[model samples]
Target: MNVLSLRNVTKTYQNHTAVNNISFDVPQGSIFGLLGPNGAGKTSLIRMITMITGVDQGEITLNGKRLNPDMILDIGYLPEERGLYKKMKVGEQLMYLAQLRGLTKQDAKRDIKEWLEKFEASTWWNKNIEELSKGMQQKIQFIATVIHKPKLLILDEPFTGLDPLNTNLIKEEIFKLNENGASIIFSTHRMEQVEEICKDIVLINNGELMLEGEMNAVKQKFKENKYSIEFDGMLPAHLKSDSFSVVEDTQKGLVIQVKPGHDSNEFLQSLIQEGIHINSFQEILPSLNDIFIKNVNNKI
Candidate 1:
């Protein structure tokens, strides 16, 4: 079941359409990527989803019901722009945020303590937000966001100020949350991170939906039948074929694109017939980064 659904949703600002008839579903318990280039209306869409702003057209639903203010407590949002009071103590800040999300004082205190300790941030409770580094402050904000144990999490550029260690630390937590039945909408410009974590994705450009699907399925949809073959000896300097084209010849391997309607097995057999001892052969699917660039550029 989809935890969140947007149907023909659109938002406009001062005669400019920021989100134009966009629609997508975020499945329950899935790590979904919400990707778009800058000025492509990602922020506008997020604002609508989080109820920070209302859609000018269409509908948004949570758990099959029309979205309402009561549903806001069920969503945990970590905006790209972090919001934390610099003068506030970390513990007090978290408690305040959690209470606002409908948690009881005692429950908020307990959850806050557990999350801080889990993030190895027990010592941060007494520290003012300004006393922490950017990464440290992010951890505090993360705790506040999740302290109420919301079912849907919208994280935008969540790793921005984090180091490698802290990045992985938060990544592990994200996975844990999803595994424990939370649905996540991860938004970022980092395609590599999306590739590693998201199972499904949607890309938007010029305020329109450009691409959407399961990650592997989307890659297959954009694949050009390219294959990478690793062989024991050097490729024949005069190698030529009408069935395929060599796109790259390097020390690591030979990357070839099979001509349309040509079978990959036929290409492999032809290489073997030419006396090349093939060690490994695998299709090189287009990366999300490659697909993102191609689609966005095409729209432009």
Candidate 2:
């Protein structure tokens, strides 16, 4: 079932439409990527989902019901702009935020302690937010965001200030949360990270829905039938055929594009007939980064 659904949702400001007739579903327990280029209305859509702003047209639902103010407690949002109070102590800040999300004082304290220990941040509890580094502060904010154990998490540029170690730490926690029945909407410009973690994705551009589907399926839809073939010997200098064209010469292989009417098998058979010792042959699918660029440029 979908944990969140937007149907022809739109938001506008005077003469400008920030989100125009957008719609998509975020499945329960799935890591979904909400991606778009800057000025593409991603922030506007996020604000509507989080109830920070209302949609100008259409509907949004949570768990099959019309979205209401009460549903806000069920969502844990880590906005791209950090919102921690610099003068506040980490432990107290977390306790406060957790309580606001409907946790009891005692429950908040217990969960806070457990989370701090889990993040290897027990010693940081007593430190003021200003005393920690940017990365350290992010950890504190992350704990606060999840302390109430909300069912839906919306994280925007979550790894911005993190180091490699801390980035992995946060990533592992994200996976753990999704495994424990949380639905995540990960919004970011980092296509590589989305490629690694997201199973489904939706792309928006110029305030309109540009693409949406399972990650692998979307890549398959954009594939250009490019293949990489690794062989033991050098390619024939005069290698020529209407069935395929070599695009590049790699260290141990040549990247070739199979002609529209031909398949990989036909090309492989042609190479075999040419006496080339083949090591490996595989299709090279377009990366999410490449797809993102192409779609935003309206090349899809």
Candidate 3:
């Protein structure tokens, strides 16, 4: 069940392509990561999805219907930039934003109260927006973003600033929101967040789709033949092999990048012959950051 689909979407500036023939589908009720480095056109694609800006070519669909004005109410967006009034009272700001999203005053108040309590920020209701910390105000804006309970939520740089504890708090809320059947499109340059929470991802680099698919499959696809081993046995200090190259070595262990077209069994058998005690050995899979670097380099 794909909740959002972009088909051959292309956006161009006066002399440069911002997004080039990008296409991907975000499954229903899943956390989808939209990732890219600075100036990679990821924001352009997101803007097109939210219809904040129109694409020069291609179409975007939500809930099996073409993108339209009515879809705005169904899609709630928290842009990379904050969108709250600084001088307004916290509670008053939320109420105004909620109504703009098409919620009735009574319903918005009820939901805002529940959300404030859930976030344990109900006591700050009367605080002036400028009185709050950046992270605190971020939470208030976050509450407004999802308070309407839209079927689809688009959050860009959702965790830009915060102490670890508050970051964890919002992470918990995001997980809970997903569990309640809301599809989420999480856009951020933070690769670790994508690795930690996203089930699928679409990466764009320099105005083109670099990759898009299940997280697990993408990791496996970009996997290199490598392993990390921890041992204390007296293996030869000057050890080298054609099949395996030492990536890093320490008194405790060694990280080896195995060469392609080599048999793992043969390599291990050689280690056994050399009397190296293998305490623990595990294959090395490319992290999201690693994959991102490889992707950008490939494009270059």
Count of backbone clashes, every candidate in sequence: 0, 0, 0
Which pairs clash in the backbone of model 2?
none
Judging by lDDT, tell me the better candidate of 1 and 2.
2
Task: Output the better candidate (1/3) by TM-score.
Answer: 1
TM-score of 2: 0.96
Q: How close is every model to the real structure, measured as TM-score?
A: 0.96, 0.96, 0.93
- Candidates by lDDT, descending order: 2, 1, 3
Residue 77 lDDT, candidate 3, scale 0-100: 87
Q: Write the per-residue lDDT of candidate 3 for residues 1-300, one digit (tens) a residue.
A: 799988999999999999999889999999999998899998888888888899799989998888998889888888998767888999999999999999999999999999899888989889999999888988998998998898999999989988898889999999999999999999998899899999999888999999989999999899887787887675575557678888888778888887888856766777788887778888888999999998988998
**Candidate 2 C-alpha lDDT tens digits along 1-300:** 999999999999999999999889999899999999998999899999999999899999999999999999999999998779989999889998999999999999999999999988899888889999888888988998888888999999999989999999999999999999999999999999999999999999989999998999999999999999899877676557788898998887889998999899987777798888898988999999999999988732
Tell me the deviation in Å of residue 125 in model 2. 2.6
Tell me, by lDDT, which candidate is best. Answer: 2
lDDT of 1 by residue, 30-57 (tens): 9999999999999899999999999899
